[model samples]
Target: MKKIIFSVLFLGVIIVLLMQTELGQMLRSGNIQEVAANIQSYGWVAFFIAIAAVVIQTFFPVIPFVLLAGANVLAFGLWVGFGVSWFAAVMAALANFALARYAARDWAEKKMGHHSFVKNLNRHAETKGFIIILLARWIPVLPSSAINTAAGISKIPFKWFLLATLLGKIPAVFFESVLGHYMINWEAHKGKLVLIGIGLVVFMLGINYVKKKKKSTLLS
Candidate 1:
């Protein structure tokens, strides 16, 4: 398990290194406008291309926020872009949820579980679990994909999971979309960035406190 994780991390580093190149950025930026402009010169075909990319994110595990979502908001107004972003993100979370539950169930149980938190999470789901999933979506830093998969293995029913996800993921993405939209107007974006930084620091402190409590319990 550790070996697999290390391999994935190593490959990620290599990919990031490659992506640091200007040429890589040019390609990955989804510069459909420039490409299509070269082909035609008058009209832009970037809209269709971006939507297609959003759909592809469901299968590909790509978070197309900058080029797809944020750019969508910037190009098209906040409402339309935000709606598309929410749909794409929910679909991706759903895909990961099922994949982790049915395909990598045993492996994930061994790796991601093995902790009291995970056990309790499962126990909650064994009874009533939708609330926890909803909370995960409410927290911006908690990846919806992780929450979805964790809930799936929590022994939560598929129907409940689906309903929770559909209802829960909306606000999360909408909030992010608003952030991205506000960011288009640079001054507001700066304030939001500072708030995000402060939020991260608080989150880390909270996590550290929890860890210390757990350690103290072990010592006792």
Candidate 2:
């Protein structure tokens, strides 16, 4: 049927998009000295590269924003990292949002016909988008990049989406930025910093759980 055909095409596109790049390999290296040298020479240029990666990386299996966000903290410091990560995250979300609103929705509606499980999910995300974004960012399983696309496509309000993206992403981005700071000065306060990140993550999770329960109850 139409659904089967659409599914096949979707799978094919996913396979094509995940093809690896040379740069992706270089950055994944754990050699801190090598990474430091590259940053020392190319720090300014790397900022733009990070932006480009956020825009294009929706295709790849890799989570480019998370990688770059961590890198910003290590190379630039916490405030710089937080700013870069937040900006890139917001820009990428906006791009994905436009694509979903303009392109994917019609195709999805046609293929799924009606009665989709996401019909309700989309409604929730659209109405309480800020909370939804916060929850998605907190939930480790869902890629923040993916959420950007989904939120856009779901026709969530632009203002809500932007607000959610900024506030919601704070927990993870802050944690990683702080984590990088610790790694840089790790011998000083190692255990304490680690505990702090863990606590923040757990607190965010509790917030997400309560929000979900309340939303579900109201929707029901």
User: How well does each candidate superpose onto the true structure, as a TM-score?
Assistant: 0.63, 0.64
Q: Candidate 1, residues 1-220: lDDT per residue as tens digits?
A: 6545653564464355336633234335555333223223223554544444454443333343533455567655578767767776766666667656766677667766675545767888856677767666776556555576676567877777787788886876676766655654557578887886798689778877987999999999
True lDDT of residue 117, candidate 1: 44
Query: Model 1 TM-score?
Result: 0.63
Model 1, residue 196: what's the lDDT?
69
Per-residue error for 205 in candidate 2, Å, reads 6.7
In TM-score terms, which candidate is top? 2
The residue-by-residue lDDT of candidate 2 on 27-122, one tens digit each, is 444444344345545658867655554444454435434545556666666687677766766776675566555556565455432433235447
Instruction: Give Cα distance to truth, residue 174, candidate 2, Å.
Output: 2.0
Worst 10 residues of 1 by lDDT: 34-43
